[model samples]
Target: MAAADSEQIRRRYDRLAPWFDSLEGILEGLLFRRLRKKLWSQASGGHILEVGVGTGKNFAFYPDGARITGIDFSPKMLEQAQRKRQRKQIAVDLAQMDVQALDYADNSFDTVIASFVFCSVPKPRRGLKELYRVCKPGGQVLLLEHVLSSNRFMDFMMNLLNPLVVKTLGANINRETLKNVQACPFRNVYTDPASSDMIKLIRAIK
Candidate 1:
């Protein structure tokens, strides 16, 4: 069952590989960059491990000389990121890995970043626990996620339509992902506005 869940999601993403860049690449990049500029104070000169680094949209904003290692389940996505390696100043090593079961040693990174990733991770809590485990003590984890709305009307519509939305976007629209991240035995969770009940900036520590 677990394998099926993983495969199904991967297949969905694989199908969307070509269109993915055009659809979410620039628009999401703009949104993420605006928020990241505000959050750079937390991440300046940090070693970064980015999960779900689809197309490497965040690569442009990472400070010069930041050590960045990116991982994603989709091979296609990582390939898209590799295409832009030259223009970047940072040291980047990207790989394909499962978020819930990372292959790195514990406390390996100075900063960890995820954007709109956790909601569809097969196992959200375990993925977060792994993220925390990989991050060094006092190092930070950053996320930008579109989570469930608190308003009953939007929540109801989301609950009804999210399954279909997930097939298209490769993520859930109504997940309480911030709550899940906070519950994952981490510390100092903070969130900023992305939309109504959709947070754009989330930072914390392992």
Candidate 2:
């Protein structure tokens, strides 16, 4: 991603921070909440790194004994997450960091996770590689994402509307996330349908 594009996304998310949760409240109640619980249940715990931990929505589902570090590129988003962390008494270290260029050492974490995040990353493959790099050799990488549909008509519609969605929401609704994951070095990569064919729960072994 270019510096300008990245900055634009950061600014957009910062502006959306305050109303982020409310904006997706209906979707959260109807679908995302259940998917999040399923995603967290697969966590190996120990040292965990959660990328794009927007507003800390996944904080409540974190398993006991997990030492979690959450990062996001937007400071305002992190601020919202911090407030949630405090209100819920969740033990997590929040930081402002970009997933495309993580600041951690190689093999720094036992598990790496993300939820509905890859579509917004300007360079999704680079971010996945960073996730692969920071995770231990035998560690787990779990993700919850919405991807381009297999249906040709729906795929065409998503591609057609993707630009408008990106312009307004800073997220692409038509990402080929499963293919991107396959391009990474992670082993045992697989995915399961989450809410629908468009949403997926991805699992990979690093």
Candidate 3:
């Protein structure tokens, strides 16, 4: 669940939500859409849970006929996602929920997915544990995230900018999320660099 800083994050995202779709659209169109498409297309038909589903950006990328439940802690962000869902006629159950403590029972979902979310989580490992707990045995967990770069210059730049970035955007630019995922209780962990080793597409099994 959210910690003491969660209210700050919520306020930040709530403030950002009004214009976030347009800004994210421009950004994703320029940089992230292709990788997101590739990653989301791999999703098979099943009961899917998407955590931190900001503006429902992945709604169009999911395979047709797949059941989806999308959750986010930010209600304002979820409102945008709901609008997009209506516009696209995408069938999804949207909820305002925290990731660290999922409301669902154990082994409830066939697949769990998140995109660019862990960097903003106040308690990432706890959130990851929840994902593991809700996912049925043999189900998959997929994530698309930006992490600290392997390149010295890029890593240094990200580190230098991280505090301000987190303050302003509620997202850390230098998170070692893939490493965190590897350390979690998941099996068959696989990672592919999605952008010059800065962004990664990760797949693991519960």
Candidate 3: pairs in clash: none
lDDT string, candidate 1, 1-206, tens digits: 36677778877777777778677658657675676566554574357888887777677666667777889898877777777665554468989998988999999898888877887788888888999999998888888777888889988999999989877766788888888877977768877654435665788876
- Per-residue CA lDDT of model 2 for 1-206, tens digit only, reads 57788899999999999999999999999999999999999998589999999999999888888899999999999999999989989999999999999999999999999999999999999999999999999998999999999999999999999999999999999999889999998878978644478999999998
Residue-wise lDDT of candidate 3 within 35-127, one digit each (tens)?
Answer: 889778766647999999998888878777778999999999999999999999999999999898899999988889999999999888888
Backbone clashes (count) for model 1: 0
Ranking by TM-score: 2, 3, 1
TM-score for candidate 2, residues paired by index? 0.98
- Candidate 1, residue 97: the lDDT equals 91
Better candidate number, 1 or 2, judged by TM-score:
2
lDDT of 3 at 65: 72
- TM-scores, all candidates, are 0.89, 0.98, 0.94
